[model samples]
Target: MEPSSASFIHLRIMQLVGYTQLYYCPKRQNLVRSNILVVYSIILCMVVITWLIYNLVDIEAHWRSLEINSVMETIEYINLIGSGAGYINSIVQSIIHCDKHLKHFKKTMEINKLFKQVLKVYVPWERLRKRLGTVAGGMFLTSFAATAYILMIALYMKWYYYIRYWLLYRILYNFCSLRYFESYMVVSAFKWTFDYLNKCLQELSFLGGKHMDAYEKKNRKFGLYLTEMNYQKQSHKNSVYFRFKILRNIYHLQWELSKVFNDIFGLSLLVNIASDFLSFLTLTYWMLTTMTTFSMALVDVVALFGFLICLVPHLLNLILICRICYLTTQSVMVMFFQASRTALFVHKIPHDPTNESHIMQIEEFSLQLLHQRITFSAFGFFNIDMNLLYTIIGATATYLIISIQFYLSAQRG
Candidate 1:
């Protein structure tokens, strides 16, 4: 749409919003790493070392060997049941540790006076931390369960316990590495969403956010004109007035939908609930099928049962990716609504094909730019990696089948 006569401030905000979308990245590694996992592991080791030194000095070597094991055991339980303590700690440390990112974001926001609400990086970080922490917790528990199940399988197969440790830890290491990268993607998604949303809303404001410069003010004035046009006792067929009404409705719908995420950092909870529901289903399947062993049909059950149970999360993960795609597309819809309103408003005016064509061209270009500039924060701030999470499920199922088979066989023999 042609730049409305909104204020220059809002125009600048639009630019910032655009640039923000281009640059927004939560897990650049150079700037931020969830570090929660690394930190927790370190703390666990420290705590274990301290305890062993005091009480197990006589069995120092053996205890030392088991120190990591003990810590992992604790993490497993905490993750399995959910630890409010961990969640609380994430909130508390986010304030201190996130200071640099906050300062940087604030400094950047200061460059543009219009969007103070979004300038505070704390909100985004809070948003990111909450969800990332949940994923981490879920990962910790699932991994432990998978590893234990694997270990049991190896044991039933008569493998050495030491070998089990080695094999399991290798898998654990790969998981940690992949997860760290996945978290990066989530962070990237957050930044992308925030920047794009800020821009789209500011433009549609018809007025502006907290700050509107010359262009935005002009746009606002134009929007005001449209509003007034609607109020006048014009015919329903008055194209200009009708156009604004349609555009206005579309913008309203978009905003309303976005507000569903307005609970500060509540997206994390919503996504987790989704994941857990899927997990519940998958686990329930496994529990039920294991009972099928009571039937004489043993070989076929042995063949496919574990595999399907394991694939549960992978299947759910497909839905999650679709969800992320849908959300991203929905966000783009807000921008489209604005552009659509602009077009309708222009169409209502007497046709100046040249001017209308130019406006349409700009609208298309702007949409493209907006899409390209989308950041990570937007997509994954609260989203989990259902993709990589599939592996954990797969491991768990394989381990379960092998272990349970051995258990049943031993009983019969």
Candidate 2:
């Protein structure tokens, strides 16, 4: 963007923040309420005293004086607070404000610092500029035909004209919206936490706060007591508890970061899917709007620009989609290998406490995800390739030649 455009965007972000009302301040609410409550309470106390005096002395003339005093006191307190607010506001203004020249100087300094930071992360600005120029020049060539083709496809996306695309879009939207994997992760995290909290409550209730406090004063975080009397005993050297503590902490931290990344990844997944649909809608709308002008030359330029902006992103996302699939598959395979290795190592321990049950558990966990959480698209475009490849399974080289001949014959017709 140009400098002027960048400045406008910065101004708009500030404007968005400025327009919001100050509705969420608990401190401000308490400050105002405390002042009012103290004044109101005093007035009520004074009136009660006056009523007692009037009843005892048979005098009611002081009632008006009492009313005036209450209102005046309230007003005076409000005036004081308002005056203090004005002075505080003036002080804040002086601290943040400056002459125009100084303001510009400060802005320039900030901009230079930000630019330096950005430059540290990015390639040289001149190199970036040259690369962008080459990309733009290429975009000018293929953009026109791609734009026209995409616009035609979009225009026919309605159910009446193109039921297949509409159905495909619906399926994709629904598939992404399914949160089974994410929900499983959340439930697992909370299950571990809930179990820990339950143990704390169970022990603390019977032991009482005094014992708990004494226990905590000795051992911070979680103190696993063998018994109340044994709580004071020294921790065994190189014990099971000591050895497992390090591993537990590692697993605990991994669980925390796992939940966090799961959330971020899930939300990004949903957002990216919605983005694809919205992009389709937006490009279609742009195409329709530009096509309404229908002068061939103008349409050609509009189509070219439209394709460059719209089609290029979709192409990039296709590449991204393939990489995402490949990486996700590879990571799952690695995790499987880790689990298999862990099981083998643990079971081979000398004089293993876990014998019969350990082997069963190892096998069960290794296959658990395969049975319950393994996701598969049972139906897809690859179904036709199954029969063809199976028929020529012994000679794969013949299958490609057959497919080529088949495609050529279909194309000729």
Q: Among these predicted structures, which one has the highest TM-score?
A: 1
Which regions of candidate 2 deviate over 4 angstroms? 1-256, 262-272, 281-302, 314-326, 341-349, 353-413
After best superposition, candidate 2 residue 87: deviation in angstroms? 37
Q: Local distance difference test, per candidate?
A: 0.39, 0.35
Please give the distance, in angstroms, between residue 177's alpha carbon in candidate 1 and its true position after superposition.
6.2
Candidate 1 accuracy as lDDT: 0.39
The segments of candidate 1 whose C-alpha lies over 4 angstroms from its true place after superposition are 1-123, 161-173, 176-184, 187-203, 206-326, 342-413
TM-score of 2: 0.26
- lDDT per residue, candidate 1, 1-413, as tens digits? 11122223332332221111112233651223335533544464455345434433333344356563543333332322222222232233333334333343333333222232332222243454456456545655654554555455546556453343335333423232232323333333434544544464444344322222443355557875655444331332233333334333333333332332222223323333333334444444445445665465654454345434333433433344434534554556566555555444333333344545535543654555355433222224443334334544576567667756775687689
